[model samples]
Target: MVKQTNVKNRKLICDKLLTFQTQLEADYSDKLYEVSRKRYAQIDDLENVHTGFKSAVKREVKSLIPFSDIYKETIKLSFERVDAQYQKVEREYKEIWKEYSDNLSLNWSILAPAVEGMATFCGKVMRVLTSSNEEIDVSKLKSILYLKELNL
Candidate 1:
């Protein structure tokens, strides 16, 4: 997966990577470039991989340029870098989800008393309206179109 969840970025990265691959092949050996391309081809979602790939390529090429295609070590490092980024993104998502859940629970806890208070007030109003209490002139309230005032 890419670092970002959006579509346009993934496409841009892929395009940049393709151009970068052509340049690397021209600058370096074909075998080395092919190894890099093969490693990248395996990944399905290439979000934030552009940055990771660049870093990994720099490190790998710097270390391996003088020598022959040290295929496994060089390619594996790049793969590790990309995979690490994927893991990091997943971890970040989980942390955000946990924070959201915690906030929702806290909100429910805080609002519970307020909800109860509203219910109590509604009960008190109904009692005043229904009871023949002289203190509350219930007749002063507006009448509903189809409802007659109830006699207690």
Candidate 2:
């Protein structure tokens, strides 16, 4: 058991959470989002209206589709151009999601302990400050965090 009479005796828990969130966001943007952007850059055509598709392929197909319309050939390939790159974009998107998920998992893993550690430290400090009570058993706090590995 522990006790503290003064409000100033305890540290604010909100500050710890805010710091964790800020660091997580920074790491996600730097480590995950940046890498994902690079992957997407490989497939993205930065020239014109085509964002998700390679520019050369889209331009070539667009030129051919107009002729296909007049010739009654109906290649129907222009609209389907993006479908070809769909897998690549999908892969990029998936990686980004996986990275974000990984970062979140990592953040939680670190934060859970950080918070618990602060609480434990604060508990002891306040305990000593206000009383000389015996220490409580904190075995369960050291337990592992079991998480399901989902098929991504």
On lDDT, the leading prediction is 1
lDDT of 2 at 87: 51
Model 1, range 1-152, lDDT digits (tens) per residue?
Answer: 45566466545544443443344433323322332243222122223233434454555444433323333433454455445655665566468658865776555787878987996787567545543212222122122111122110
Worst 10 residues of 2 by lDDT: 143-152
Query: Please, what is the whole-model Cα lDDT of each candidate in the order they appear?
Result: 0.41, 0.35
lDDT against true structure, model 2:
0.35
lDDT of 2 at 133: 28
**CA RMSD of all predictions:** 31.4, 30.9
Stretches of model 2 off by over 4 angstroms after superposition = 1-75, 99-152
lDDT of 1: 0.41
Q: List the residue pairs that clash in candidate 2.
A: none
For candidate 2, write residues 1-152 as lDDT tens digits. 24553333233322332333343233323322332343233222221212322233334333433333321221233224333445555576668768875776545775888887896787666545643122322111111000011100
**Each model's TM-score, in the order given?**
0.27, 0.24
Candidate with maximal TM-score: 1
TM-score for predicted model 2 compared with the true structure: 0.24
| Clashes per model (N, Cα, C within 3 A) | 3, 0
Could you give me the TM-score of model 1 versus the true structure?
0.27
